[model samples]
Target: MTRTPASRRDDYPVFRRLQTRWMDNDQYGHMNNAVHYALFDTAVNGWLIEEGLLAETGAEAYFLVAETGCHYHSELAFPGWVDAGLRIAHLGTTSAVYHIGLFAEGSGTAAADGRFVHVHVVRGTHRPMPIPEAARQVLARLFPAA
Candidate 1:
């Protein structure tokens, strides 16, 4: 059986709103599981970019997704809107694990919850690099409990 969705909205310090697209739903009439990853990526990267921590094409520091997974609690279809809640679960020297919850607009409960783990690497060498100080500060706000 599919896992019940878990809400971490209260746990997250910030959220990014995303509008659904007609193509997001599958023939089954609900948003496909694949789309969850897209939303996760968009929320995280969008925040990173907006905070001036990430460069789209020419940054010395880059992040590569190392792991991701999601659990859905309810059905969400196309033309709907969602708020992607984000928080830092774990921050290592070169990797950060983020917890994410997707809430339907005006819904306090989460439609899905999951994690995104990314490993920071140097652009030229592709080797693990420590998280930049700037990004860490923005990310640290999410880690206040740490």
Candidate 2:
């Protein structure tokens, strides 16, 4: 199988700083693979929340994770900070793909890189729907040149 290269923090359009918790570490000492996925989820979802796109009372639709994958370039443990760099790879009428890079504090290279595709659907009906204009506006910031 071919290998994918890790992305640099500079390649991303936005970043979220997340703290590694004590429970994030595995018996092997480094963070468990599951935690990395959690970080990816936290980064993307947290950004949306911060941008005022997601709210408990006003939410109309929910973006469901349709697919995700990750590649690790280095190991990370607890008690340190991680920078989750984010960018948009694609945005369709009802779907969006986000690319993320997890960088250790003060490191230029990424410890892990990942991508996830989300499909927008009505909250109660679960039927596919077009992404809201507000969401598109915020997502466009991640692709300024597009």
Candidate 3:
């Protein structure tokens, strides 16, 4: 079954503004398909870092992307900015599923939407590990009420 894309910016609880690079566009004159995943990765990890849940290095644990998929509703190209809207769809012991909506600046509907799954792992061994309590608390803030 196909899922409908989020139709409003307010569907997400957090937003991250990203400047689109000219290089992000493909010969088709639109952002490359792969670039959507890059934006999703940047939005989620950047938020984690901002919340003190992740570090560039020397952290006890960190998250690694396990799965990701995107659905496009409209086109996005360079020479513009993207507002990535983020929320936690599922938060488990060792992983979380992040839902993201990519909206063209000032647009209420998402140009694209996707899910990114991150699994917490030990820094050195990379073994699966429970998400840190501190991180969980912070992530919980992104959970929208059902």
lDDT of 2 by residue, 1-146 (tens): 88788788788889999999999999999999999999999999999888876647547888889899999999999989999999989999998999999999999999999998889888888788998888898888876243
Predicted candidate 1 versus true structure: per-residue lDDT over 25-137, tens digit per residue: 99998898899999999999998888876666987878999899998888777888999998989998899999888999888888899899989998888799999777777
In candidate 1 the C-alpha lDDT for residue 69 amounts to 91
* Weakest 10 consecutive residues of candidate 3 by summed lDDT: 2-11
* Least well predicted 10-residue stretch by lDDT in candidate 1: 137-146
Model 2 residue 40 lDDT? 93
Tens digits of per-residue lDDT for model 3 on 86-145?
999999999999999999999999999989999999888879999878888999999975
Q: What TM-scores do the predictions have? A: 0.90, 0.93, 0.93
All candidates in order of TM-score, best leading: 3, 2, 1
Candidate RMSDs in order: 2.0, 1.6, 1.5
TM-score for candidate 3, residues paired by index: 0.93
**Worst ten in a row by lDDT for model 2:** 52-61
Model 1 residue runs over 4 Å out of place are: 1-5, 144-146
lDDT of 3 at 104: 98
lDDT of each: 0.86, 0.89, 0.91
